[model samples]
Target: MSDKASLAVLLCNLGTPEEPTPAGVRQFLKPFLSDPRVVEVPRPIWMLILHAFILPFRPKPVAEGYKGIWKEYGGSPLRKITQSQVEKLQQQMSENSVLVDYAFTYGTPGLVEQITHYRDKAERVLILPLYPQYSCSTTAAIYDQIGKYNLGQRDVADVYVIKDYYRQSLYRKALAESVDAFWQKHGRGDHLLMSYHGVPQAYADKGDPYYQQCLDTSTNLAADLALAEGEHTVSFQSRLGKAPWLQPYTDVTVRELAAKGVKTLDVICPSFSVDCLETLEEITEENGEYFTEAGGKTLRLIPCLNDSASHIDMMAAIIAPFVDVQATGQK
Candidate 1:
């Protein structure tokens, strides 16, 4: 590996608890929930609520939930998978002038530290947040931290961010292929459910494009599968707080579909680039219970496109435009 590379690619993802324990979950959640982009309430009030209300009580159950889904070899599934992605991407991008690394939004190998490491070593950095849809809460937080890092640095590497790639042809095709492959193994479900992580409805009203982008991904995927209106549905999941979130909530929709006598339901969370606690436990374990209790036979949770060949190819294609600038000596 070169000590100094012309380009660095940082694959970013929403982080996980270092350990599937109460203390670990709290440590990860504190910074994650405290971010203004995430919670969106006034500082003082939110701080009081966070410390006095949420933190003290939230960690115990969240930790337990994490333990339920912790990867077999140990450690958070998100961390293990993201590290695998870094290795695979590095191997694929094998250009002598490029280095590949990864960082978490809230935990180990943080964004600021990673960005600073590359600033002195590379001419340019590409920050890929790994969220198919763009959200002020997720993608903007990366931009926010990078902007802050640049504030203290005298020399900064040119940064390129992939804001949203849900619309890209490769992305849509990869998702469609993944879904079809799953069906081929288990046979097709009676209905398909595309469940994306939810953002607060207020954010959507205020011009966050997250919700709309999720819709576009679902719409395109449904078209790719060539399914009719009654054959598939779209819903949002993993919402927090009592406040309203994107409509047709996943849990509610799953229960309703089961109660209405739809036996086999296939669920795919497209917003997630890799399987994490939310998809593994919340959707698969928790919501699977919801479907079964409400009379559904089976709830098949389609896996995320984590570090797969097609996914890697899509990422390489997405990063090619930046590499082109490097090849052209266009700083």
Candidate 2:
């Protein structure tokens, strides 16, 4: 293949701001919130509310949260860990493997930019969105971007999208392993909370499938961990606009657990492949406070499987078949 990658694997994740500032958050959030797949609100009305309320006010606090979690060297934890994932995956795949790269759905090295870059360089491109559970607000947004890009190109590279892979045994195993490792280091908590990012209930009512998928992921992980129903709970986090997101909200659920006398709680975000502002600042600091204030002794946030060996193994396992197909000159 003339030392060029005939097959390209693009790891797509929910994005982060280029800088941990309100202006940076504002720049990243505009396009992200504008997407109809994400907000599910009429553009004219949503735009008014978004600009008048969300953009003007939300960014400052959001940026401060980002700054709290931001690395002095790497800026955003999400972006930094995603970069590590791609680099390590490429190494694991070895020198002659497909070109392994990463892009953000909302920030620099955007969908269209990476799509066009790979299209011009490789014959086949595989988009592996890091979202384990598919949501129209998340995974489908990537598909929407790809569809838009292809509309302008007559001869686009053959593209294959892995919409969702939460069902893969490896993914479940990785979650189990991470939890086990965490518990080994820090004593097990009274309860384990599997928290996934929230989407509007309207989206679920419209058959988004995200709510159910989150439950399924939690179920499988619980099975892997051999936990009884009472040992763990599933909740949703990072809700925006508060028009009734997925029920049993994480914050509320955490407080309720604390109030119920469950001390030393452990929380994990299966929906997040990398640690971002949501997982780092919101889940840890913000929710931790709620837990403590509500009477819980400890709230430990188990880290995501970002660039972990098992996570890379899962990525390689998921992409192996596609690479084999590319090698045989088959789509």
Candidate 3:
């Protein structure tokens, strides 16, 4: 490829273990949890606790959880799905003279390696973190990694990062359409729960826009689907530690809904661009049981966009403007 054939888009996501084993889970978690962006606690204390307490006991159970959701293809669902997203995006943008690839914020095919590989080859590189909402923990961590990598480089390519697209029209439409399709197939449920991955309240209070962004996406999605006030609800999930996170917490809200006599529920995670452990296991498996135990009949999970054609179209549209700006610069 000529130097001009050097436009590359690096699609990024939080990673998963290479294998569903304790050792593999530990390796993935150590670096991931250690990131100051992820855990705001002071490093020295956090490290001691992590190494002594968390790593020893946490990995085995987490690995078991991973085992439950591990794809038959022999890796975490996140990895396989992300790889598929990259491949589909490549095909979708094939005629545009751009190269598309993906990397993880943690684990294999890391950010630095992927960035460096394309650095010399691509004159203009777009770093699109798969997170639709900007959060210090997610999108900012991608920025941090790219910033760190550039520090060691003598020559850096022009880089563009997509911070968030929470309210993007095409994206919201894609999400709404996904939900509509799900309902059409299974029939509409009594309630639609929009669950987002939660961050600590401290982080939101300090100025992370993630909480509000998630709310915005939920509202717009509801509007797109013409959902009435009582038809849907928004909550946060996947919170860890004792620290308070953005609420109403998903599990709590789910139980409350069930107790309130809502028999059927359809849940979706709008914040997640793809389905992973949180959706596959936590929401579907664990929370499904919670709903049933609480007197609700069914808890249906609408899968994330993943490599679906609509999702690919949305991604292509999202990246088009950035690509155009770079192409203009080349002239």
Give TM-scores for every candidate, taking all chains together and pairing residue i with residue i. 0.96, 0.96, 0.96
lDDT, candidate 3, 1-331, per-residue tens: 2556457898899998888899998999999999999999998999999999999999998887889888553667787888899999999877675889998999889988888887666777888889999999999998998888778778765788999988788888889899989989999999999999999999999999998899888889988999899899999999988999999999999999999999999999988988888999899988999999999999999999998898999899988876645444454
Which one wins on lDDT? 1
Each model's lDDT comes to 0.89, 0.88, 0.88
TM-score result, candidate 2: 0.96
lDDT score, residue 56, model 2?
94
* Residue 280, candidate 3: alpha-carbon lDDT: 90
Residue-level lDDT of model 2, residues 1-331, one tens digit each, is 5555668899998788889899999999999999888887878999999989999998998888888777543577887788899999999876444888988898889977998888767778999999999999888989988888888888865889998999998998998999999999998999999999998899899889889889999889998999998999999998887599998899999999999999999999999999888888888899999999999989999999998999999999998877755555555
lDDT for position 23 in model 3: 98
Assess the local accuracy of residue 87 in candidate 3 as a C-alpha lDDT between 0 and 100.
Answer: 92
lDDT of 2: 0.88
For model 2, the stretches where C-alpha displacement exceeds 4 angstroms are: 1-3, 71-74, 325-331
Cα misplacement distance, residue 38 of candidate 2 (Å) = 0.7
Give a tens-digit lDDT track for model 1, residues 66-105: 8877845377788888888888888888854678899888
Candidate RMSDs in order: 2.2, 2.0, 2.1
* Stretches of candidate 1 exceeding 4 Å from the true structure: 1-3, 71-73, 324-331
Q: Each model's number of backbone clashes?
A: 0, 0, 0
